[model samples]
Target: MKWPLSKKMETSLLACAIHKGEKLTNYCTDHNHLCCSKCVELNHRRCLQVTPLPLAATGKSTDFKNLSVSTENALSQLKYYETYQKDRMKSLKVSYKEHESLIVDGLRLEIMSFLLQCETSTVNRTHEHMQYTVIDMREKIKYLLADFEKSTIKEKKEELNLKQAPLKVVTNSCIRLHYELFHLHVAIPKVLDKPELSFIASTKCLENIQQSDIFIKENFSNKVFTVNGKSVHNVKMPSDSFTCDILAVCALPNGQVLVADRFNVKVKLLNQLYRVVSHLDVKQKQLGMCLITPSEVAVAGHDEVQFITVSHSQLAKGRKLKLQYRCCGIAHHQGDLYICSPTALYKFTLSGKLVCRLFEDTSADYTVWKCAVSPTGDRLYISSWYKHKLLTLARDGTLLATYTDPALLSPHGLHVTPAGQVLVCGWLSSTVLQVGWEGQSKLATLATMEDGVRWPRSVCYSSTTSSIIVGQWEDDTILVFRVE
Candidate 1:
């Protein structure tokens, strides 16, 4: 029995096998043209062998099952390829969208840095358009794959009646073939390499901020601290063989003071008028110090604390306290000294008795340095130098909250104001930031390098004189800011 090629099949195969609305009826074996009569007359005029279509078809019966199986197998491979390409396209869409989200999030940080410096604009039109283009292509691919389900691949399956009792069937084979031949070779790279987004802000707003004093004050959140150049009190250390790098300072009730000259390993006593009275040399380099009592203070070195007292208008050394680990910062609260090492915080008595190792950070990158307790002694704040975080802990050293800000860079000194505000010295940024107890908000900046403060390593509030004293890293000058 012979099944003649239908008009639809002629239209489908016309581009390569049929001519002028005529179905291919004969196999011109000599010319290899399965052609209509017109094609035989025009191209195969000298052919020696010509077979009727049904006779040629009959000869191919033994291989019909093999031909159908091979075609189905090839289409099956195409189906798998098509599905993979479609999934990859969807993945690319999802991936690019995630990338766009991340890029915008990072841009938000950049925008925060530019807040006081410039004027910002809305999202870029070109960036949004490019993102939409990718989305549109993904939708188009989805619809195209769906439309392909009705094409020759599926139609051939039904025409051969192999859909139910499948002889190795393949699905969406045409869509797969189209993806490999066209989309993979042409579309993917362009979509992947499309320009993302770049945020641009104008700097003209800075001048407007300068001119409007009220706006400037309001923009910085009402607590704007300008440099009191005149109120800057300095105690010039004598030019001696020792490097007089003032790193820490504390004020006493009787108008006297203590200064930690770190490189020189000496703690200098200052008189009521910020004049140097006497210097007590220590065995190790003095880093952080706090007032333990009205007449005495405790200073921290690598692994020891030297208790010094102000007596007879001179600096006198008292009992030395040794610890198992190294000490970096010290804070005094309720007669107990809270000390910080590079990795842990410890509480010890005045007579060098260890209370407890309060907290140890073994989870992540720990760079715990300077620490301070709130006025109420309810919260302990620690500055992590490398992590760029200010950690607020409970009195017993339980972790409470972690604070981070773009303005906070290399935070070193930790000082909690009498009002429970945490003042931090951003060493690299050269700005002193006063934050809240919860580390949730920034209150104000007490001083910056514009106030002649250079590399401030330690900061302490003096309730006696109502002033905040700032000490530097390798410089001699100590800045005293009158906190209004």
Candidate 2:
């Protein structure tokens, strides 16, 4: 009795049915089948030529390899889309909560105005209306975001999994979608539940959406900077005898600027025209300054951080945060304060509680002279005046990169723009250079000595007028460059 062939062995043999005892060695491409050479010769002599089985198998293997690569790319894209959606959801919640707070604060201001007018009945009605309106608006947004998560976002995710080409087609769609959502979030507060304003907001949102779409099509190129004009404004006060030493500059949301006058021991506010409109005497010499709110600023003094508020073009002293370390430079991100001593950088809460020592450089007395946080709050930059270096750090105090340039020497001030460009000024070089977001390379020389940037001590960017403000050492005037 013949030993039964194993199923695997029989499959490997792959004998042709029509050709008895003949192994299949050729593939008929036209008919798409495997057959013995004898069978091909007998049945397909006039037909298209047959290929060897190995050659046909090689071609099929190549096709499968191409398919595998495509699958991997599609999977990678889907993973990215998943992460983007999750982040967008988190941002949505944060933005809505912030807008809600703004609405409450705005209503309170309105109530105060009503009280001043002595309209008791109107105040009561307005207060009650505001409470009801805020509740209604919050509920609307809550439901809207819930519906969006349950419907639009979820449906898109499912579609991405089901179809691969569509994922590629809409890979950049999130940018436009984010712009639309952000525009709506901004417009909601301006609307105040008014129908006419809502219509206007919708129109403006459409325009922004269109612009975002155009931007996406262009592959989000870097913005080109051109100097549109330049001007100088003297920040020296009539009461001060010493020349101004503006060590740091902070730009507010309402087109106003605040400069830390180290020599005069004052924090001076500049209006839209770059003229000093108001000043607050901080007893000790001030160093770095940062915007705490749209109407408030925190100036770092010798050993304390002084908080000042701006109202109706006037400056008023507020609370002060006393630090254990000398406060030479200060920056704010989210709810945390980054205060820099000459040799160390510390993170503190608004109430003066120390969070942690973020960084320290004891090599020199002024190794960490000034600090600034990026808009996203992920990266922190510190200017080392003595070392002539810019150190970038992660939020957790991990050193990311150290940047040095010939155009930048004795870097005294660090300012991260809303667009995430890092602007650093060299005190000794009298130059202002824009560094990349990672603080790894210098992107451009924004201003030089020829551009009237003399002994630049601090740099700030005002988005409202598209201008760069440079504060100088021992100079009564600050240089402002309007750029596009």
TM-score per candidate, chains pooled: 0.52, 0.58
Worst 10 residues of 2 by lDDT: 215-224
- For residue 152, what is the lDDT in candidate 1? 36
Model 1, span 307-333: residue lDDT tens: 898986798899888888789889988
lDDT against the true structure, each candidate: 0.64, 0.73
Summed backbone clashes in each candidate are 0, 0
Question: Model 1, residue 133: displacement in angstroms?
Answer: 99
Candidate 2 contains a number of clashing pairs equal to 0
List residue ranges in candidate 2 displaced over 4 A.
1-224
Model 1 error, position 453 (Å) = 2.4
